[model samples]
Target: LEWAGDEFPWVLEHHSNLEPETQTWHSKLVTENWDSPIIFTSMVQFLEVLFGGGSRGARRMHNIANSVLIFDEIQSLPVNCVHLFCNAIQFFVDHARSTTLLCTATQPLLDNLKFPDKGQLTLPDDRELVGNMTEVFEQFKRVEIKNLVRPKGWSEQKLIELMITQLKEKGNCLVIVNTKKWAKKLYDRCINSVDADSLFHLSTSLCPVHRKEVFNTVRQRLDDELPVLCISTQLIEAGVDVDFNSVIRFLAGLDSIAQAAGRCNRNGNLDMAQVYVVNPQDEAIDMLPDIKEGREKALRIFSEKDETELLDPEVMSLYFSYYFYERANLMSYPLTEKQAGRKDSLLSLLSDNHLNIGIEKNAIKLQQSFKTAGKAFKAIDSPTQAVIVPYGDKGKEIIAGLCADFEPAKAFKLLKEAQKYSVNVFPNVWRKLIDAEAVKPVQKGEGIYFLEERFYSENFGLSTEVVSKMDTKIS
Candidate 1:
């Protein structure tokens, strides 16, 4: 909205349809005409329509039949959905005649995916969209990665000092950490050391509105050539377009490192930018299995090759190939159950007519378990529930509107606006808040929750500190 201005006919279609314009555009996109030339939607929405059991989903399938489908950040696709997703893509290309593009800095080996009875999902003519991809990688190389990980990781104080030093040496700096807890802690320490305006923080905990405001301020400062420091989680690693003179990243996947590098000297304006990879002492590697595995594989690659090889296309291909090989079983939706010991996957349920047939006294009848399979397909492993936090005046207004008796449409509008003030919390933390009466259900059995003012902080949207302290007091 900031780049193209509000007048531009565009829509952001995610869970948060906060704007009426966006809501209108989304409604239009799912309709028969699908009049919107440009439409943005989540992967869940895309998959749901393909495998979802409903008349609405059927209608959406028809609407998307011949549309040009583009999947960005293709690496982020869940491993469990790889087979199901690949099968859907093949269906789109062969049956629907749709043009599909999977764009990512670190492209997975989709051709290696094996489908039941369908064989490997192969691209037509096995052609490359961009010939000589190595040349493209070399041309885009603007930053040099410096490995700072050691046996003993750097302390929080040491990390903060290093960041301050970088800010002084470099005009602007960005620090990407592994977790929100670390990001907030580093931000607090950095805020004390630097000017309030120069220091910034970004995390999933903050509402979309708050994050947008922070991004706008950071951009303005960067444009003006002022001192700016942003401490963020992996949220800023992809899709976000911002350039910093120097970047400090915690040890993660090589693809994640590449994405982080893309943020530094992004436009090739700088002569050479620096990207530092450090291992933080405070973070627990065991808590994050994916990062641990990626780090292990990345470290092995680094041992074999030079640091500059990090940006090489062949090296990236090797990293992805190794990464996928480690979790090969996950490529197939293994968690999905079978019917009467009959091997069945979401792909089979959606695509195979024989699997959908059941014999009743020698009579074949259609019996596809679309709803059951759809319910099991989760893009993210640990699903989060959204809770509206009392952040500012707009948040208060949304809460007041929700409490009052309004029409269903008006209530939905309020809910959308509330999305900007919402924080996604795990079920355990949500239960703790509920027990403490710090939050209330927006509606019974609706899954929507609301946080009271006391539990919220202006600095941090939803304050876990308040919840913890309250729990202590109660105990």
Candidate 2:
């Protein structure tokens, strides 16, 4: 029940019209069987259960014990909670008897930091596991990073003007900006200036299924060599695999820049494509260390010479070297047992052998977690109803196969297994839901989606605070 767009059965059940039996069974399977086995949820879901509030959340709370948990985009965890989050994770893996997997293309430098030696779990060396990611990145080099440095300022107009040329020539391009507002602004400009069908708006505004639909459509166009233009926030920076002939990135961190580069000519078909690093007016992205540190690191390295030379990996390595060095510091913190907070941290919640000692107490704790989950779910975009888009013959067959040994928690897994047939909300849609807020328009703007502040508050589950403290550094 910690449901979101990417979790399909939940989405199907939440957004699609479904039979009563299917819906009842889905609820029972998720709520009653807390220890059913594998659970597929997002980083936000897991974090909310641990630190925030809901009812279905508590139902699945105790189940964290004695299972393997995987967190996608672990780096996206809020910065302030990194220590607490990682420590809790360490407790779960070592003491609570659960194993965890941090899945992402760009691994956050979590395991490298210091924590209690007693509770530490072994994580693979991401650098080695990825084995010279830079080398692999070179082979996949479909892009060349271009610097668009102009003291006059880079306007949305200028960005779209250049992108229009790329779209007409190559028929596909992706533009990534630091925020949703900028993405919307650019997306509107493109649509108004060019063929609307050829231009696509992608953001966290749409649900996951909606985003997935858009992504699939875009992918098909790329495959068919049809004209397509997409404007999006940095959410699509990692994991998403579609590539374009060119990518124009608003100036941000080096890691973000590298992530933007990863999206271009990723199939290695074409020679190097172009990735323009341009500075956009009216926003400072380098507000956080992750944002500021990399760009600043790149700037410091290039201060004695030309900025354009910094795009080469040999030169860019300095950016990451300095960037990770600072990131490592952010990861460093001392943890005492008292700071562990949860009583479960002291007593293993998973062990059946210890069950006799605090059975009632644990029940109460689980109930609390569920209550919190319910509260939190309401704040974020929770599924109000399930959606049932008719599946083609292949999709029906795939769904039939999953129904054979179906577990409700495996809804997303089954949907993913059936990717050949169906489409759920892609990840970016949820990102938009989580990021964009409904606010009244302060200025007259075309193609702009105005949102109310209450909607923004609700979209973030009314939990996370809006952060505007971006780094003011130039270059």
Instruction: Tell me the TM-score of each prediction against the true structure.
Output: 0.82, 0.60
| Decoy 2 TM-score against native | 0.60
lDDT digits (tens) for residues 98-147 of candidate 1 = 88898888887778743344434567675578888898888878998898
Off by over 4 Å in 1: 1-12, 16-38, 44-63, 114-121, 125-129, 336-368, 467-475
* Per-residue lDDT over 1-475 for candidate 2, one digit per residue giving the tens place of the 0 to 100 score: 4455642333212122121212344444433323433445456546545644434445556878787876665546654345546667877877999877776554555554443332223565552445676677556555667777566668767877888888887768888887766776786566567765566666654445446677887788788888878888887875898988888887776667778887888887786688878877766554344555555665566464454444455555555456555554343222233432332321122122132333355544342333222232221223322222223334345445444554655654444433233222323443453465422211123111122223322111111234222311111
CA lDDT scores, all candidates in order: 0.72, 0.53
Candidate 2 has an lDDT of: 0.53
